[model samples]
Structure formats: C-alpha cells, structure tokens
Target: MFKINNLSVKFIILIILFASLIFGCTNNKINQIEDLRKNNNELNKTDTSSSPTKLTPKNTIIDLENTDSEERLLNNIFSSVAPSVVHINITKEMDVPSNQNIPDSFGFNFGIPDEPEQYFERGEGSGFVYDKEGHIVTNYHVVENAEVLEVSFIDGLTVKAKYIGGDPDSDLAVIKVLSDPSILYPVQLGNSDNTFIGQRAITIGNPFGQTWSLTAGVVSAVGRTMRSGNSAFSIPEMIQTDAAINPGNSGGPLLNSNGEVLGVNTMILSQSRSSSGVGFAVPVNIVKMVVPNIIANGTYIYPWLGVTLSNISLDIIDAMNLDLKQRGALIINVFDDSPAANSGLRDSQKNIEVSGGTITIGGDIVVSINETEVQTSDDVISYLVKYTQPKDTIVLKVLRDNTIIPIEVILDPRPGK
Candidate 1:
C-alpha cells in the first residue's frame, strides 16, 4: 500500500494539472513604451508635435534581461487566452441500481448498504472558451458521463459548467458557464491549413484540475490519423507532436510560435501511461469543421463517399491483372442512387469466389483523380479530400479490360439517405 499525505497529493495534482505550461519561459513582459525622441529639427515642423525643444535628445532603452526567448510568446498566449481556459473537475455517480450483488456472507468485512449509495468519482481536464457567450471547448471523454462539472480559473474563481455538445468521433466537446463575457479572455483562431510541421506547439489547460498550466513542443507531423471513443469512426488529418501530454491534458490548445491556436491536444501513446514522445492533437481544421455545426445545430456533418475502397497492392495488381496500379479506387460496393452511381461508377455485381467465402466483382476500378495519382485507397480519399468537395466532379481514370475509361464522378456527402 502506498501512503501519501494530503498535501503531497495536492502538490502532485498541481504539477500534473499544469502539464505543459510551466517550462522554458523567460520573463519578458511586453510594454509598449512610446519612443519619445525628437528628430533634431525635422520634428519641430509637425502640426502638433508636443512642443519639440530639441537640444541633444537621447533615447531611453529598457532591456529586460530575465526575459527568455519564449517569454513573449507565453505572455501573449496566456494573457489573452487564460480566462477562456478552465480547470474542470468532473464528479461521476458510480453507483447503479442492479440486481447483481455479492452476498454479505462472503469472507470480506465490507458490506453493501441496502440502499444504493453514491460513489463520488472525480476526474480532471481542461477546456477553452469557444464563443463570446462563454461556450468552452474540451475533449468529449474528459467529461464522459460526469454528473457534476466544476470549472475554475487561475484567479481563484469557479463556476459550474454545463455540457453543450460532443462528438465522440472527434473526441471534442463544447461547454458553457454562466459568466461575464467582458472579463473572459478568448483565444484567437488561426488557420490550421497553414500549420507546418516543426513549428512550435504549445498547450495550456488544467491538467488534473490544476488551473493555468501550459507546455510547449514542436509539431511532429501533419496529416496524421487516429480513432477515439465507442463509435470507432476514423479521424483523419490529426497533428502529431513530441510534447509532454499527460492524462489530464485533454482538450487543451496546441499553439504555434506566433501564439495562434493550431490544434487541441487529445491523446497520448505512452507505455508508462504518461506523456511519451508521441502526443496527438486534433487539428484545428477538423475542430473548425465540426465545432460550429455542433454549437449551432447540436450535431456535426461529415463528408462521405458512397463506395467502399481497398488498397491496391502489388499482389492485387498482379492477381487482378490491373493495367496500372496507380489508377484509382477499386470500388468494392456502391450505394444505390448515390452520386457515384448516378455519375456512372459501377458496383460489383455478385460475390466472386476466392480464398475468401465471398467476393464482389463487376464494379469499376477507379484509377486516378484529376492530376493526382491514386495508388491506394488512402490516396483516393486524400485526393478527394484535397481536390473535391461535396457535389463536386471527380475525374476517375478507370481500367476496364484492355480498354480505359475516363469517368467524371461527382462526390457526395456521407451517411446517404
């Protein structure tokens, strides 16, 4: 049994709570001191030049030596955005009324009460204000099934937060607190499309309910993918980083060097169950794509393709006798009345017997899209995601025996009705 004092637990919680925001900062507070110096005689001719009596005017220089290179970034980022972020303590009622129960005669001194008792389950995470009306953004799993949500700030203020919206697919959620908007420090949204790998990435949040914690790292990779929650839907275009993200760092902002928000830190892969070299961020591109609809409409819209696709391998290329592997997506199945079907993308007719029990044939194999090469299923999806939008035309270079066909396929949204 591990014994720890209350203050020790509190300190550990505090350190974990401010996961990424405490290190590598040099205190250089930025002050806009006007450079008040007269330009010899030319300054004396201005319309309202504060009575320029220039003899030999010297300038005052203030160099804050303790300021580190990143202090400016920290100040600008934390000052303008700290209020938007909040320390969240979620309490869940773990007791459930169920017939499954252990007998009191078991060799255990513990006994269950006749009535269902409340078990206070507590967890901590972070969130950011998403809207002027005090809407906050955080990870969905951070507050999963939590009965009570308490939000706090660095200034010793606290409020009860209300659940707004969540998409398990993206692992993101919105929360709101009834508070004064005038005192709220909202973060500015940046263009994630412009975010590049190797740029500085920063995170700020309440890790383990310790408020106003911040950390920084560089963008490790772009266009990465991950999956989250029970629905098991795929998340694409995620950002990978080497930042130190721990358990309670969920839903914190991953920032660029310019102090612009780039992503939201959501998960980590570690053997020790702490931050390893790999931390994953939900790119702000995906966040912006989903959050507004979630805020306004209480749901998210996803772009979909009607056909299932498979990656083309050298074996599949040889076995299928493909003309060229870099043609397009090999459609295994197509939905009825889909835009792909209407656009003449055919589906496999019946099950083709192979090593497997059933296989489909007859569907047209897609070769290429516009000028982009489609060597695999991922290639096809990436090509479509980059070049085509909903109800947009996609030129598919298809192979049909010895004859090649150029088909103009119009893309459609997912979840076809």
Candidate 2:
C-alpha cells in the first residue's frame, strides 16, 4: 500500500470484493436458517391430533399385536405332522477302490490287495407314517440296496426298519418299523387330482441331514410328467412345487395347508444338487395306486403298450403332410413282442429334417385312448396309469394314412416289473 504499483492497486480491490461477498452470503444463510426454524415451530404448534395421521411410513408399520392366520396354520401343521415324519438312516456297502501296483526306488514291487475293501456308506432321508401298521412311505431310491435302515421319530425313538416292498417305476417304497401305534401318526393322504396351481404347498422333511425342517411354497404346476431314473417309463400326473427340497428331503411328504399329504418329495432340478426352487413330487394318486400294490406284491405292475411314443412336432406334421394344428402321440417305435407290435400298430419308417433336428415321420399318430382324446404322449401315459391295468384290453384311435383307425391292444405288465 505504501509503494502502490498498478498490479498492487488491482490486488487490493479484489480482496475487498471477496470479503464483501463472503459477509453477504453469511447473512443470507443466517436468515434462511431462522425462517426454517420458524416454519418448524409453526408446524409443531399445529393440531395433529385432529387429523390423526401416521408419522411412520406405511411400509415400515408393524402389527405387533396381531398374528397372521397363515403363519399360525403353518406352525400348527408343523406341530401336528412332526410326529408322523421320520428320519431314515441308511447304511450301504460301498466298494473301496484298490490301489494299483507301485515299485519302490530300489525296484522292489509292492502289490495291492487282491480283493477290494468294502466300507459302509451312511446316508439319510425322510419318510412319513403311512398307516397304523407302521408302514412308512418313502422313495425307492432312499432304500435302494440299503443294507440297514434305522428310523427315528420325533420323540427320539429310533427303531430298525425292514424294507417291505419297493416299486422303481413309481419311485415308491414301503418300509415297516415295529413301533408303538401311539407313536405312529399316519398323515392323511390328499387327492392330488384336486390340487391346483398356486395352492399352498408345504413340506416336512430332513433336508441336508437336518431333521424335521419345514418349508413352504405353492404348487407351481400339476399333471406334470417326470422321467424316472430307475425305469424307462415316465411318471405322469406329477405335482411340481417351488418347495426347497434338498438331498435328504427325498421320500418326505409334500403337504397342503390342511396338513394333508399331497405327494412324496422325489427329486429337484438343480445344478448345485440342492433345491433351486424347482422340485417335483410323485402325486398322491400314484402313491395310492402303487403303494398298495407294492405292499401286496413285491412290485407294482404298470400297464404297458411297449411303444416308444413322441409328441407330434412341426417337422413330423410337414413330413406327414398334416395340418399345422395337428396334435397327437406319434408311434416312434413299437417293440417286438409288445402289445403295440402284436396289435399291428405301426412305427415310424421315414426320417425328415426340421429346424431342431432329424425326426421320424409316417408313424401312426395316436389320437385317442379308450375313446378319450389324447393330445400327446403324456395323455396316453396318464390314461394308462389312471384308468387301464395290465391285461386290460383298450382301443387306440390312431391317424394312419390320413385315416383314423382303431386298434385293440391287450396291455402287458411293464418289463422288469
């Protein structure tokens, strides 16, 4: 300031302007804060009691005093069915691989055991009491080749079980435990045919070796077809659910909201070998049909036509010069000596390529079974399982050479039955 150059004078003026701007902004902020405080005071003084508005957000509101009825029902179901549910412990003999011959550094030979060593592989699954006679319903795979079976009840009572009968076609097995009648709570079997999609589905099982675990979901689908790993036949009228069924859940009861047994939890579709929410159960109707037969005999005899059937595809339709809307079960191959073969039912003789792949055509397309209209192979299988029995003569209305022809076939017991 004492020796004022032109630059020094400009710098002094800039400092004065910046100081004025800061003071002005400070004053304005103080006024705005005071106004906000006044508005808050006015709002607080207002009579909120007259309107009675909820201060909390609607989504965050909690009904602490009230209990959800569905939740209570779930709890009730678990309590009532826990006694009927059982933990099945399996002991299977596994062949341990023998080591190959190895030579030491000194060229000395070391020989492995001549016979492979065997060890017991322990596994567990779940089951439900089927009757007062101590018959426990479970999956056949659960007890397949099982050397020893031990069943544990909710009361911590463990008893040895003997496999009475098993049907691999239906994946159902009956194991009898000599337990007290008082401890055996047979689950009420529900009619799976009456089940509908979106109906509540519940499961009581031992998932991942954890016993008595309960899961809840809804029926994803009904009347589904699931291929059996134990047989060449497919299980029809299956119940599909989103229920979390894991490794140890096989053979457990898939229940309804009323605690009635709807199906037997059999398998799940997953990459991790655990529940990915796509689980399937053998319908109780199939259980009703198969279990009694298994108990009476060693196996359940399924009605077989011995024809490998395929759904009519677009390629097949085009190859056969059929309507685009044509739907039926196409006869792919008729096994020799089968009912279909003996009845003169024809198989596909021509091959045609489609967008997907090559397909066989010129086969007799099954349009109806026993006078019932069939749209696909599933209809035929379901009809066989539900209505026809082995040795029963049935008529199939088939589309052959653009003409419907009726063929009578006497059903035979499925192979390996």
Candidate 3:
C-alpha cells in the first residue's frame, strides 16, 4: 500500500482540480502580443525624407485635412490625463556594508561597506490624481515598504509626495503632493458599470521609466476576479482587459472612449513578467469603496463574518453521521464576542462525557440562510453583502445530528471593534 503522505498529496491534488473546475478561464484569448511588439518601436516613429520639397515641390499649400473624431478623442483623453498622471519612484531599505557609505549635500548616506553592502531597493511605477486636494492613487505593492516617494507629471513638474493611506487587502494606496488644487488635474470619473466588452480603453503611464505614454484597447471583460498582489485576500470584481498594461502601468488610468477614468490598471497575469494579454484593473467601484475611508481614516474596512471555517471532509461527515444532504459553510471557530456568539449559535467545540468516556465538539454545518439555499460559504457571504447595512438580520438553517435548527443572527461591518 502507498504511504499516508501519498494519499494526502492525492487529496490535495483533487481539491486543486475541483477549484480549477469552479474557476476556469472565462474565455480563451488569442495572444498576438509578440506580433504586436515585433515592430512597435518603429510603429510609433515616422521619418520624413530630408526635405520633400527638394525632391518634389517648393512650398506646396499643405492644407492639412481636419483631424478625425478618433484623433480628437485620443487628443482630449491624453490632454485630460497628461497633467494628473504622475510617475512614482520608490526606495526601499536593504542591508548593505556599513563602512562603505557615501554622503550627499545634506548628508544622505548610501553605498557599499566592507563587511556587508548597504542596499536600497529602488523601483518606479506611476499614479494619477485621485482628488482635487493633491491626492493620488497607486498600487499598494508598488510602495508597500517604500521609504521615499517622488512624483512627476508631463508638465516637467516633480515633487516629493507623502504616504497618506493604504489598504493591502485591496492593493491600493493614496498619496498626496504639497501643491495647489489648480495645479492638479483631477481625472473625471467614469462609470465602470457603463463599460462593456468591445468598448475602448486607454491607459497612460511610465512603463520602464518611459513617461506620459498612451495605449488603447477595447474593454476585454468586466467583473474579472483574480488573486494577484493580494495573496491573502482575493481582489474581487476585477476589470479584465487586453489593453497591454505593463510593468509601469500600475496606477495608471483605465479610460473609456469618452475620456473618463474607469479604473486604475493594477495587475497583469503573465508568464514572462510582462503584459501577456491578461491584464486586470481594480474596478473603480472598489476604489470608490475604499478611497473615502482611506482618506478619512487611513484605512479601509471589509465585511467580516467573525468566525473561522474549514472545509469539511467527506470522511469526517460520514464518521460523525451528520446529514450529508445539506451543503453550506461548516463553522469551525467563532470568536467569543462575534455576532454569531450572541445569536445562540452553538459552537460544537465542547468536550462531553458520553457515559464514562469523552466527546469532541466544534461547529455545525450552516445549510441555508433564510429561504435561500446556501450552496457554499461564498453564497452565504454574497447574500449578506446585498444588505445595505450591518444591522440587518439573517436566518440560517443548520443541520445537527438528524435534526434541523433555525438560527437568526445580526450582521456587523468588518474590521470591527
């Protein structure tokens, strides 16, 4: 017989397979990234023969025809975005040699040492004006552990910015420069809900230190959820695009055809560390959800269930003789002061003496919420999110032993006290 470790590995493989089946690709995209980049360097650049007049005519009345609507749209989009979009340069601390250091004018130390080299993790990305009061939006991972921030715009203006607020759960940050409101060109917000597949999208950013560049593509998709920089939490309702968002594209505006900002381009799913036709933008909806809280309180809040859960195994269900027909979140741990704790919901984690021996207890399976069926834990949470406030109450049907019990519980906002 094979070892138990082998059986565990097999079980793990099966779970991963199940997850993949549940979350498969929405569509099979045809990647022409290579073909597009093959001559992109030459594509943007055009050269004219030394003097066409010398070869042809003297000063022909070049009655340059009027620009088309597309050109006008592009020009307007770029003009509205050029002033607000800014470049970000970050310096993270790294250990280096202590002795090998050099000083600058006001005496900023940086260099290599004899024993170890003192290092600074310097990197660059971009951001855009998020508000009128000098506030800007960017990716959290871009300046996660940054020490200094330098922002630059297209008008040859650069300034040192201050880290105002950030949320790692959503992978967003808010920064601000010390400047007048008129100097900052705030981007006009667009309704992401208005964006549909095949609608145009434009992004302006400093990719690879190349500043104030614009690229366009159609809205590839909407409500695309993925696990990108936020490894712990799933960034939900993402906007997927084939818009060629690259390394420095993070925090750039994802604009609609009407020159309105829909989202801030954040993550790219690529095999070669570049835009591979699979790019994701944190939906402006999420930005709108988190930005106000971050600006006011320096933090963002999420809805929390205040309980811990673990996937129930088939073997455990069979051994416990629990009802197998019911499907929902199996409660594992409930906090002492949680909403569930005051709802008369019993946590099964109690040691009991049957007759002379012992009994182990924990959590019962939540089979349903209200009249709606809880197919999975996600369904339970999704239903709760539809509620406008936490004061609302929800009814849960739980299966314990061979009997079904109803439990009513009040909800509370996450990141709670």
Candidate 4:
C-alpha cells in the first residue's frame, strides 16, 4: 500500500510538469506569429507610400496647361513683332525701244531706231521699322532702282517712303517714312553672336504678297556665306534656318523667342523659287554694323586687299611642294600700286599643271590675318570685310619658301572707290 501511493504521487508531479512545458511553448509561438504579422504590416505600408501614383485626369490637365503656355509664348511674340513689320512695294521705270517699225512709205528709212518707250516695273518685299525716326531696314535688292516706294503697315496704313541709303556688299538698305513717331514700332535687336544651332527662330514677313505672315523654326546653322545676285562679293556670316521664307519674305525680320530681331530674311535655296526648307538671313550683328553706316553714308566701302586669292588645295600642295597639312589663302596676283603691292607681298610666279588642273605656284600663302586663320579666300575676305575698314592696318602671317613671315599692310578702299 505504501509503494502504490508513492508511485501515484510521482506520476501526478510528472503530468503537471509536462503540461507547464507544453503551455509555455504554445505562448512563445503565439508571440512569434504576432511579431511576424507586425513586420509584414509595416513593410506593406512603406510600399504603398513609396510607389508612384497612377496617372489621373489631374495630370492630363497639367499637361494641357503646359502646352497652352507654349502657345501663349508664340502668340505673344507674333503680336509684339508683327506691328513692326512692313510691306514695301517699289516701282521702277525702264526704257525699251518702241515696237513700231518705220513705214517704208514715209521715207528711204535711214536705219535709225524710233524713240524708246517708258514703262513701269513693279516689285514687292518686306521691311521693319528700325527706330523712332521712322527709319526702316530692308534688303538692298528690295529697294534697288526704286523710283517709288510705298510702305504699308499691318493696320492698313500706307505712306510714301524715300530711299535713305543702301550697301550691296552686305545686301542691306535703309528707307525713311515721313510718318508720326507714334505709329512706328521699332523692333528690339538681339545678339546674334550668342545664338546657337537648334534655338528657336521666328520670322514675320510678307510672303507672296501675304502681309505679316508668321513662321517658326529652329536655327539650322550659323557662319554661312552666300553670294549676292550676280555680284563678286558675298554676304558673310549668314544665319541659316528652316523657316518658311519665300520671295517676298526678303528684308523681313527673323526674330528670336523673345521677339528680338536676330537676322534679316534674305534668300532661300529652292529650285521652284519658293521655300525649300532652307532659307538664309543676314545676321543681326552684320545688320547692326551696316545699318548705321548706311544711314550716314550712301554706300558702304569694303576694305580692299588688292590681291586675287586662291584656296590651298591638295593639287596646289603637291605642285608647290607645300606642307600637306597647311591650309591658307594663296596670293595669286597682287595689283600694281595697291595695298598688297605696297606691303611687298609676293604673287604667283607661274601656273603649273597638276592632277587637278592648273595650280599657281611661287606665291606667299596667307596662313593667318590679324590672328584669324585664313583657310580660304572667303575667310580672308570675310574677316577684312567684317572687322577692318579703310586705312586700317592688318598683320598677315605669310608662308614663303617654307619660312613663316609677318607682313603688315594698310588697307585701302575697294578698287574704284
């Protein structure tokens, strides 16, 4: 009986201990599950807060507003600049022989011709008000030989304008209208030297007689040269753009996004005599230089170098034994008693046949002028025409007999000044 009682007590003690252990383990697992649930909730909250919001109607509205702002900018530019634009019409008189043949019945016809008949030829172009003095700036070709000039504003106001002056070398001209200063809106000039390719370019002009037409594009290129119509000289440092400029658009202002004048629409490269997505403008910097001179003088005097120049090419290099890498303007013929001759510059001694044709030899090659590289004849011409004037002295780095020499020449007015 004693043994049985002891065993029963021991079994009871073991059951109590085992029950405590099982309950303790269940509580611990519950705590672990709770901690895991808390961590997962925090992670989900963070993900929800960090993810991008779905695009909604509000975002669409914002995009529309941005587009509207761009439209407003272009509209504002046009409104401010169109008033300064003008339509110019010119009439010229020409003499042509009369079509009437001498009647044989009148006399033994001394083959003398009949009196010439006078007729009026008309042309149209565009221009802009330049200043408060009612001065207008335009292309020289626009007002060339103009006997009568009629200037029309955007508001249907027309006035008779007189030719002030012009410079064909720059293809720029100025005219004056005797109008009230209150009616004239002068355009602001922008610094074209700061212009970059792909910047916004705007133009306002009369194209095909459509007055005050507006076009927009980006600057396609800078520092270009174009020859004036049938002229030996070329307009240099032109701004090329894809603006829709046509025949009558000549002389109109090319503006920047700020409505400031960046250039003057001059010409277009097209086979159909229309816009071919390639139009050129005389840079505003050149306009600034030439306009003031045109207003004071009747014509611009180009600085004369008095030498025919040829570009250094591979053929000339091989024929003259010149350095293959050297590029410059080759002096072909220095005129007598001219600035080049007075400066003791040497010209070509002879012409020799090369692979490319006849190449001139025995001439001093101009490598640099006034610290500017003279890589071609155009470079020398453009640099002198833009930066130097008559009586100005320029330093030329010349290459002679494989020796570099510096020559100083005092510029003179263009031949036949």
Top candidate on TM-score is 2
lDDT tens digits, residue span 346-395, model 1 = 76665545564555555577767786666556666555544456777767
Superposed on all Cα atoms, model 1 deviates from the true structure by an RMSD in Å of: 22.2
Per-residue lDDT of 356 in model 1: 42
Per-model CA lDDT versus the true structure? 0.73, 0.92, 0.76, 0.89
Comparison by TM-score, 2 against 3, better one: 2
What's the lDDT for residue 363 in model 1? Answer: 59
Relative to the unseen true structure, what is the C-alpha lDDT of residue 261 in candidate 3, on a scale of 0 to 100?
A: 81
Cα RMSD for candidates in order: 22.2, 11.1, 27.2, 20.2
Q: Assess candidate 1 and give its lDDT.
A: 0.73
- Candidate 1 has what TM-score? 0.68
53-85 per-residue lDDT for model 3 (tens digits): 545464554333588878778877887778889
Tens digit of per-residue lDDT, candidate 2, span 264-306: 9999999999999999999999999989888888778888899
Put down candidate 4 lDDT per residue, 1-417, tens digits, no spaces. 456588899999999999999999999999999999999998777566578977688325333354677677877898799999999999998876554555587675544454547779999999999999999999999999899999999889999999989887778999999999998999999998888899899999999998889999999998887887735778887899998999899999999989999999999999999999999999999998889888888777888889988888878888788878989999999999999999999999888886667777889999999899877887887798779999999999999999999999999998654
Clashing pairs in 4: none
What stretches of model 3 exceed 4 Å from their correct place?
1-68, 96-113, 116-118, 306-407, 411-417
Tell me each candidate's TM-score: 0.68, 0.82, 0.64, 0.77
